[model samples]
Target: MNPRRKKRLLFASVLIGGVAAIASLLLFALNSNLDLFFTPTEVVQGREETGLMPEVGQRIRVGGMVVEGSVDRDPNSLKIAFDIADSGPAITVLYDGMLPDLFREGQGIVAQGTLIEPHVLEASEVLAKHDENYMPPEIAEAMGESHNKMEYSKGSY
Candidate 1:
């Protein structure tokens, strides 16, 4: 207890345990590379004010609207599948490749990947909407109030 104050309390407890092991390994590598961004009615009715669903296989990022006819392609190739919606319930997704040319259906997209259930989603990157008053502020805050009446009739309020 007195060898130079036990070597300054063992170098201040090894520099506070190496800054608490690098802040818990940088919060477990940012929570294992978090994606999380659900919508399709918060992935089948969950996150309306923290009901917080998403957890089949995790890695989310859905967004919405694309459910018009629920595009389902697969002419023996670039796979597909659809259904996205936000006004409530609809998820599906799937995907395999080549889809952004302003996609289709009711428009508005996002995708990303993994969730595999609780309403599907397997996409590995879909992203559409590259024009017509761009909307992706987390799908206009999860399409609330129908994106404020389509940004007040496109005057973009």
Candidate 2:
């Protein structure tokens, strides 16, 4: 084979191999790290396509607004239960951990854990979701402020 042709073939093979490696890595990362986001309404509507229910030893996320007057903590066990709600039904979340400082009633929260039983989420991780209107200045600038509305109005200020 001509030296130039041999060099071109080698370069093409390397390029193809590199592309395949990158594609494989991307697929692996996506499959491993991707988690589904669901609202309380969706969960209540039975729309979870993956059949990821609140079953023992399963990892899942349950997101909704925390129902007011529904948060209770057991002093000795550190077990906490709160009602997670959307526009429709609500699900109860049970977690045993150090709750986040910002976690409170009526706030949006996403709990990650397994369903110990029907309508009960045993959370291993809890995430407090910032309101849609709350964003960093940079994000606000990039996304625009049209959708941002302060939950607390100037009248309170």
Candidate 3:
């Protein structure tokens, strides 16, 4: 092959490889920035697997049972505080927004926000389990019970 043609081919190959590398890097960065929510059980068991606890101001989701009698709202500020519990520890969440219709004390909830403190989550979004069978799969698995076997209504609040 001619020297000039060989040089041109090598340059093209390098360029293509560089583009592919850049594309892969961009994809990886995007994925890493997209935060995920986890139940308390999941956070306790799989923090290493799921990168890290979101830094302050970084968005995240947390799921757990709403602590009974822990839901309180500030009438003027519209800020709400509730406690979320797993088998191990409970996380206190402060949210400033309208909660979902299903959100209530003693219900399963997934709150999305940033961790302002180690055990305090400042939630911007709150999703409550809709019904007895409405638990997220991850929460159900973490709780070690199949959704089919658990009757939400049977539990006496």
Which one is best on lDDT?
A: 1
- Model 3, 8-119: lDDT tens digits are 9999999999999999999999986776876665454446565555555656788878877898889898799989876556788998888888787767888888878767
Q: List candidate 2 segments past 4 Å from native.
A: 1-34, 48-57, 130-132, 135-157
lDDT of model 2 at residue 43?
Answer: 55
**TM-score of each model, in listed order:** 0.39, 0.59, 0.75
> Candidate 1: misplaced stretches above 4 Å?
13-15, 26-30, 40-59, 63-68, 81-83, 88-94, 97-122, 125-157
Model 1 C-alpha lDDT per residue in residues 1-157, reported as the tens digit of each score? 6799999999999999999999999999999998988788777877768788887988888888786677989899999888888777787888888988878777788898998788898999988888767888877866768856644655631
Candidate 1 displacement at residue 136 in angstroms: 23
lDDT of 1: 0.82
Give each prediction's root-mean-square deviation over alpha carbons. 13.0, 7.0, 3.7
lDDT score of model 2?
0.68
**Model 2 agreement with the true structure over 1-157: per-residue lDDT tens digits:** 9999999999999999999999999999986665555555555566646664333444567776678799999978989999987656788899998888778776667787776766778888987755544533422342233213323432221
Task: TM-score for candidate 1, please give it.
Answer: 0.39
Error of 2 at 67 (Å): 0.2
Q: Kindly report the root-mean-square deviation of model 3 from the true structure over all alpha carbons.
A: 3.7
Mind sharing the TM-score for model 2?
0.59
Cα deviation in Å at residue 126, candidate 1?
Answer: 12
Q: Which stretches of candidate 3 lie over 4 Å from their true place?
A: 1-3, 10-14, 41-58, 145-157
